[model samples]
Target: MDRGTTDRTLLSPERRRADRTRLIDGVVDVLVIGGGVTGAGAALDAASRGLSVGLLEARDWAAGTSSRSSKLIHGGLRYLEQLAFPLVHEALQERSRLVTTIAPHLVRPLPFLLPLTSPVWQRAYYGAGVALYDALGAALTADRGVPTHRHLSRRAALAEFPGLRRDAIRGAIRYWDAQVDDARHTLAVVRTAAGLGAAALSSARVTALLRDGGDDAAPVVGVRVADLTDGSSFVVRARSVVAATGVWSDDVGEMLGDAAPSLRVRASKGVHLVVPRDAIDGGEFARGASGGVATAGGPDEQRPGLILRTPTSVLFVIPWGEQWIVGTTDTPWRLDRDHPAASSADIGYLLGQVNRVLTRPLTPDRIIGVYAGLRPLLAGEADQTSRLSREHAVVTPAPGLVLVAGGKYTTYRVMAADAVDAATEGLPGVPESRTAQLPLVGAHRWNAVKDAAPDLAAAAGLPEDTVARLLQRHGDQVGAVLALAASDPELARPLPGAPAHLAAEVVHAVTAEGALHLDDVLTRRTRVSITTPHRGTESARAVAELMRGVLGWDDERTDREVAHYEARVAAERESQRMPDDRTADAARLGAPDVRAAV
Candidate 1:
């Protein structure tokens, strides 16, 4: 399809209204529950195979574990220690597929430094593991987009990362992995699937499962979905249903009636802290303290990133634009899943672990944002959550229902392919998965569009950096966003609070992306919530006003939306200050869900 036609295929409000009608009218080949990365991938895989598909999500896309990931697409380096060679190998292959052909715009290469503490044995120990990691990646994909690993001397390591305390590290090993805006990548997958004729709907909850024979022996046939936006329920008939809910797998499994779930999902909470890049970098902090003195090469130029071995788990201090993302704490969590609360202890644990290696310590005041997510781990004999397998499993507890669980974000595509493969059993003429070779909506002509970024920047009257950021986020679809700016020059202006994003992008979030609420736009559609000091509260009103035109919200509705978003931010901030999970959960629950309130 042409670009304009493709843009029209977006999950806009009009398309969503039409999709609801079509979903209730037709019997589709496959119905997917959940709109996270895996479910989105499943929709794309099934739709591209010529199967009629519909995907439904209870909340916004990537509102769960998918958005709050460590954001690295790597063959788990630590998985090698557990001898999960096959798992690591598979993830490495998928990583290459993502960085090269699939969604190159969203995913890119990033360098990491693994510091050497002990002199000789530490270097050799890490060197062999990293070499094997690189070798596995090279063997799996012909063009492993990332570079190989190399060793650095003590002096060389210090030169590369001045943030590391000289006494803390002996040397360092440099390696390459890929990173992504996880939420954006997930949304792009959904958009790509929708363009391929898949029915994608958010804020639609699966209230119950439909049966063909109305008994325990009966096969699962479809689902009764409740439109959370309008409080209307409709039945979507399908030949098969795939439950891809991450942490809520068991809850869906209950819909099987008397059939016991073969697998159980354990929630492991992981929290991340977003702080200014200068917080942990000594040189930048020193420069800032000295009346904004300019440095030749900035803090990021000096230190790419760092990964430290903590007592509980590995801590990664990743470079993200003008900010640094440090995390994460892996602990057992049985609290609320909708809003996983990161307690004061969780923040303290991360800060202490990361501070162990840093020359300049990071305090609570430096933290701009904090988010917690749960990993849907397969229940195993291992008591510790870290020991649970990263490998995924696909099970058919009933004739028509397929459940997929227990996989890392890096291997979501493989998990989705497996789920669809299981769901297509006994069906005739279903084609093999073509998603591996199929690039996402914006990725098809990304290289050509990226090459023209400079000219596009000049024509649009935007800084080259702004255009580059747009290209990385939107790929060839950047033209559609630029078109909005062209028609209204004001749309080209940067957002007042979050200057990294343009106002046009906010409008695109509503018109093109399936952003049903202001929280969806601020937190998931863009990184404004995490990147800004006010947690996007300062820009919430402006974004809501921009969205009002597209959504047809009146003045009162706009005020309500902004107020709801602000309440959510306040609750999150309060939760972060709480001492324990119990108090944190209570604090987070203080913010009423906008859908529920409506």
Candidate 2:
């Protein structure tokens, strides 16, 4: 009733805390650390339950492991071999929820095919395994929407994928899964949490955890936060804390002193290469005759065991918008967790695996982009790193400290729910979680909006493909973007170099979404950084010009943004050429951020 706060907007910074409140009031119901998908999810969960939530990130949103993932949302088929039935089943359930109920706009079913190498027993064994995979999913949800597994004879497989070596495949098997833009999904979760009244700020690191061990271990009270954008510090108090830092969970745990639990999270490095779609001959799902095995999320019938792969991780070649995404080597990592590099060895391994099955081989010259990310694999006894369970844990080390770690990208929601539940242990009358039923910002009534995509396209005077792309990226939010275009027809034009992206989206990222830097908009908001021919460099000037007014960048800042982005692209290109992590990291470090690194 007291209009004490200035900005009443759901996500405005002023609504964060009253001016009278010292940054160190250090008193809130929940203080969530980490800006990955899990941390964002935890903030949304806690805030939705009527808890005073403040989420702090050491870097930009999705800056770490969240942005660097295989970008798939699926029940782990590989888990079946490990006999982790429950984990697989749980992930499958979450996957279904994401596609149908949660974030349909960002997640979609992808198809993949697994070619059979051996002649007889391999085909039967693999077929049965795939049957089990499909049947498991079918029982969990009505109309899982993913097509059932399909079997293909040797001739049929070869006909479907002519790029495959004639002698390599005895037959084939196919299955289905889902894929996503991991970084975008992570940011969406964070933005949705902000919209729900969560105090979410990135580029702010938690320097210390306040412990009142003398007062019956008063629930972790607050955190010392350092603004990475500028050399300033503030104290944010909270009644409870949730640490959802993925591979870096140990750092957060140490802040809790002796109260920190003995938790181990292994880091597994995975690397991917981006190439032009035309560079590799491939089918729609690599099921057409042009490719060896197209891993886009379909059942494979040729192999002994059913396998489902995406263009992002499969041994087969698959197509992205105008490019192809390939390779994913799961190897142990013991270096700086911040910027994982794709070594020449990692690249060679993937190229070798894919080339073994392809009629034409992929060379280094064809690769345009490469990215590497570390997975927070739950540690296990020796000889089991790759097999480590993905089930996340949320443990309270001190009165105010709740540390969460070790979960797959698909199960982030569940991990978040658990972390908030841990943080609200002694809080009075906290409401139950509403995230399960809460559609993300873009998910409301997507069905209706999708049906109207053609009309929207006609109105924008763009091709249907452009409209469909917008719908996939923004869902119902497309209306807001379209309205902006209507006000200024110039906003309706496609961004240079990235024809699929509308100029309005770039403007929207700055004005609405919490994108404070050029990298934020290009790399996360629009994904032009990874999915483009020039890796977003070709469109850098246009994007910088569009943001000139919103970000208040003068000619110098605009030039700095463009120059920074170009250097970044060049560094990434050079990093891809390095033989090992040390060399690769040096190349990447050549382009330091204009602002201080978080």
Cα lDDT of all candidates, in order? 0.87, 0.73
Please write out the lDDT profile of model 1 over residues 108-186, one tens digit for every residue. Answer: 7777889999969889999999999999999966688877888998887887778888999889998888888899999
lDDT of 1 at 396: 91
lDDT of 2 by residue, 1-598 (tens): 1122112212323333332143355356777889899999998898778776778887778988888777778788777766777878878888878877788777766666688887689878878877878877877779574667788887877765666777878888867777777887887787677666677777778888776654435556777888875678888877777889989888877766666678878898888778876676554433332111112222221211123243433443444556677757777887767767777888998888778777888888788777788999877885545556777777777666778899899989888988888777777787777887677777777776755656888987777777777777777777667877888988989999988788988888776566667887888887788777688989999999998876678998789888988998888788788898788878888888645643
TM-score per candidate, chains pooled: 0.96, 0.89
Q: Which ten residues in a row have the lowest lDDT in candidate 2?
A: 1-10
Model 2 regions lying over 4 Å from their true place: 1-26, 213-219, 285-318
TM-score of 2: 0.89
**Which pairs, if any, clash in model 1?**
none
Best candidate (score: TM-score): 1
